[model samples]
Target chain A: MSQYELAVILGMTAVTFLIRYSFFALGDKVQFPPLVKRALRYVPVAVLTAIVVPMVLLPDGRQWQLDWRNAWLLGALVSAFIAWRFNHLLAAMGGGMAVFFLWRWLLA
Target chain B: MTTTYHPTRHGELLQGARDSLPMLAGAAPFGIIFGTLAGPSGLSLLGAMGMSLFVFAGSSQFIALTLLSGGAGLAVIVFTTFVVNLRHALYSATLLPHVAALGQRWRIPLAFWLTDETFAVVQHRYGAADASPLKHWYHLGSSLAMYGNWIVWTLVGVLLGRSFEGLDKLGLEFAMVATFTGIVVSLLKTRPMVAAAIAAGAVALLARDMPYKLGLLLAALAGVVVGVLLEGRNATEEGQA
Candidate 1:
């Protein structure tokens, strides 16, 4: 809406394009070293963890308080356990949804 | 070994559809949510669909939609979308070697269609002890299927948003978190991986309120650092053993 907001949005777009374009533009020219390659292997796992963990553990804030209102932690556990044992996506999702719904109902 | 069962383009499309079911499962809901919310944010169905078609990434689309509704400038929208979609650069880079030999014509389309699910499937097929070109077909098949699913679901959301009201506050937003949790849990398969995930998650929690989605970037950095540290320690222990 404001000029400042416009600047931020456009700036983000430029940065994103720059990041993506670098890969295509430089990928053929640049050779990644072995250490960098190995490190890249772990990036996804780490990034994903960082994204998921906080959402489950501290849904609202950094208070670190766990209560019935936030069913994310329980749902995550249920899903993880099911996925570990059964190795099925539908099953894990279903288990999580069921737990989350049940937890919400019981707590309510 | 790679030559056996070379799938025709049609066959690849069919297979891509079937293989994309898991991706579609999450994609459909997310796409719809994006659609439903975009309308309330002052975007038209055409605008929303156009965004989906062009951007093709859910989070970035949502960010763009929010910026648009809030009357943010085009520059801001583009910049935020770029930052949010930065991960795609990493994704494309990782997938480059596997798809390199496909030649320029096929390479462009294939690269364009590559999504997270496609990347995972393609990476697995590439790693398997097979040299078949049909593996590319598998990637193609799954990607096209996901592409269709995303378009269709986004359309549904647009239609729903146009006709129905009051669906936004029905709490469909939680599905996003649920989907992310599912993805993260499934991806964590090893002890060090799990530890790194926890560390990053903790960091994200601490940095949740940071402006401009810095939390995600910081969390990713923290996770990488923790994983590298753990890996180094493990290597040393193995050497000592």
Candidate 2:
């Protein structure tokens, strides 16, 4: 890697650490109101949805294609269903992996 | 009213470490992935381990790696990763209520280890009213375990990235997303969460082609907007009725 790349990576590492550490340094002193408290509850669901949906839907890093190639999405959907039903992390993970592997094998 | 916690000597810190050990079980494999992947990006063994020790965020590290592999601009990579990790602010806020009682010194170190696993375990304990001493002990044990698991597996990944070449085939990369799905599924106990998730997913799909991680930002903003609007409408309707 070039020196610039090395410097960039190091800089990122520092920035990430600063963000994590900032919580302890500043978050403790501040208390949020009830409305803001209620708002925070939605954050994880929002952020997680935003992150997961795009990746599963567009894994090839192109225009959003809706086809059988998106077996990953199907696998994720099935896993979501299992998770909703069982409310267990291990079960959800196992179900997704099972469907994904099964799809890959059948197609191959 | 302010309640002050009594201070303890440095020896007591070991108790804190011992308390955090149980969480290592989940973190071990996760850390290994980070370590192994870091080397392929031209990071030295020490560099990989240092990233895990200092950064300690699996998703952000992976995001950084993706940008590095793509040979994207440094500014873009940094900006994207920063946006991706903005959720840490939310996690910190969620955990503040519990650690507020720990006082200042313990607060900083406790927050340092506040990964998703740590926050989940700690928040669960915090929510339980009149928790037994065993609860805190369990959390402390888990946190320490997670920390050790992270450090050791990171070293292993850095040193042995070549040997475990096919680990990606196992789809462990998807496990991180799957974990988030599981959490989202478990937490959607109300109408607003349902609306918010759908809104976010829709925005993400719509903005899928946006560059520089704008899709994620847009999706998150959409979710927040939808949630706030829905809740506001509900409150107003309740008042009128």
Candidate 3:
């Protein structure tokens, strides 16, 4: 590994570990305000949705590919529906990947 | 409502591992895909494994790889990593109450091993009303399972990527989206949660061009604000009614 790559890895590791360990390290010495605690409840849904939306709507990461030909969008929709109905992670991923590959082939 | 069954620490640990099986499955493709891409993206084998071993956060690692491949500087890549993994802070905060009583030795490793998958399963375990004093063992179990699973799959992918071709182009990364979708759907039991998802999605769409992937952070903040406001409004309406 180049020195630059090593530095990047070390920097990323430090930052990530600190973020994960911050609260646990503080333990009972610090407590979030009530509103902050309430807001924490929505973080998972919000952050995951934020990440998923751009990935699905703009698979290319640059353009907006909102159409029938966009297999990612279609597959993600199907995946979301499956997850909502079955609440099963494996089923959702399996079903979604199936749809994604199938739709891509059909379009190709 | 008292039950006669009491699980031992070892039992809780094993149960935690068992419960994380689905998440292990979900994360497998992602880990393998990262390994396959790491080599082609100019990372040495040790560097790639070091990332999986140390960074341990899937999405941030992916983002870091992307930024690196794009010729981004170390500072930019590191800043992006911070932004992408900032959500983990919220996770640790959410889980802090349950783990606060533990010693630093336990907290340190547990915190290090925490990921989205482990958080989902371990948090659920913590939320359960069982009277198990050894729930931290359950957390340890899930953590070790995910950590080991990630390393193994990354090794598999790294080896496979060397001999095989075009594994990254197979669109297997979509598995992550599907898994995250499942998690979000399951977490959407409340109206605020549903609103949070919608608000986050909309803002992400609108803010897609933000530099250093700051859009994700902005979108999440917007969603949280919208959710909190809606929850407050609902509480007021219910009070008046």
Candidate 4:
């Protein structure tokens, strides 16, 4: 690997470790205020949703592409419905993949 | 508090590993896909496997591979991966109360081994009201199992590369979309949570072009702020009434 590649890996490892270690590193020495704690609670759902929304809405990760060819969007909706009903991660994955391929084939 | 933990270290370790089977199932496909894509992902074999060994976050790894293949700048790749993983801080915070006394030896490795799958399984173990003190072993069990699973599958993907030419084109990534669907649906338990999700999603799309994914960073902050502010207002209104 080149110097730049090594730099990317090292930089990522440092930042990732810091975020993961923040609370443990702090331990009893520091305490989060109540409001910050409340906000922290919402981080998971909000962040995960944000990450996927663009993936679903924009196939190229560049712009909004809403059309029949966008099987990802349809599959995403189907996956959401499955998740709500079944509440199984693997099952939702399977169900969504099944629908995605089916939509792709049908559209083709 | 209902279930008793295993008496021995080995027993708890096995139990943690066993209990994580369902979650392991969820992470396996993604791991394999990453390995298969790694070469085409333009990374040296060392780079591909090394990332799984070190960075260890599935989503961020995939994002990094994508940007690297596209020749995105190193700073952009690093910053984007970092933003994607910001959620881990919340995961660490949730588990801190249970793990506070474990000290660095245990806590650091646990943090390193922690992944979305391990968190899902171990969080339940930690959240349970059981009087058992072996929750850390259980945490180790799940995290280590996830760690091992990632390494083994990446190797498998590397070995299976090229022969599976159509794998990436298969649109199998929809499985992740499906998995996130389940996660978001389950977690949207309140009004503020839903509001946060919407704000984050809207802002992410609007800010996609922002350099270094600053839009995503801002979106995450916006979501948290909106949720917390709404929660505070709701509590105040109820208090006055």
**Top model number, lDDT:** 3
* Cα lDDT, model 1, residue A23: 50
DockQ of each: 0.35, 0.36, 0.56, 0.48
- Put down candidate 4 lDDT per residue, B69-119, tens digits, no spaces: 899897888788778787677778877777888888998999888776666
Write down the TM-score of every candidate. Answer: 0.75, 0.73, 0.81, 0.75
Question: Can you write out model 3's per-residue Cα lDDT over B1-241, one digit (the tens) per residue?
Answer: 0122238888888888876775777678778888988988888889889899999988888888888888989999888888878878878988898888899999999989988778866765676667688889989989999999999988888888865455556676676677677678878888988999999999999998886567888998999999999999999999999
Query: lDDT per residue, candidate 2, B1-241, as tens digits?
Result: 0011113333223443443333353355666777888767766666666667666677677777777777778788777767766656666776665555565666665656666666554554454454343344444544565666788888887777767765555544465455566656766777878999999999988987776557776787788888988998989999999
Considering the two chains of model 4, state its CAPRI-style docking category: acceptable
Specify the highest-TM-score model's number: 3
Candidate 2 local lDDT, residue B79: 77
lDDT of 2 at B161: 77
Ranking by TM-score: 3, 1, 4, 2
The window of 10 residues in a row where model 3 chain B has the poorest summed lDDT is B1-10
* Positional deviation of residue B175's Cα in model 2 after best superposition, in angstroms: 2.4
True lDDT of residue A61, candidate 2? 59
Order of models, best lDDT first:
3, 4, 2, 1
In candidate 2, stretches whose alpha carbon ends up further than 4 angstroms from where it belongs are A1-14, A26-28, A63-71, A88-90, B1-42, B62-84, B116-150, B161-163, B209-214
Cα lDDT for residue A39, candidate 3: 89
Pick by DockQ: which candidate is best?
3
Give the residue spans of candidate 3 off by over 4 A. Answer: A1-6, A63-71, A82-108, B1-15, B18-26, B36-42, B62-77, B128-135, B160-162
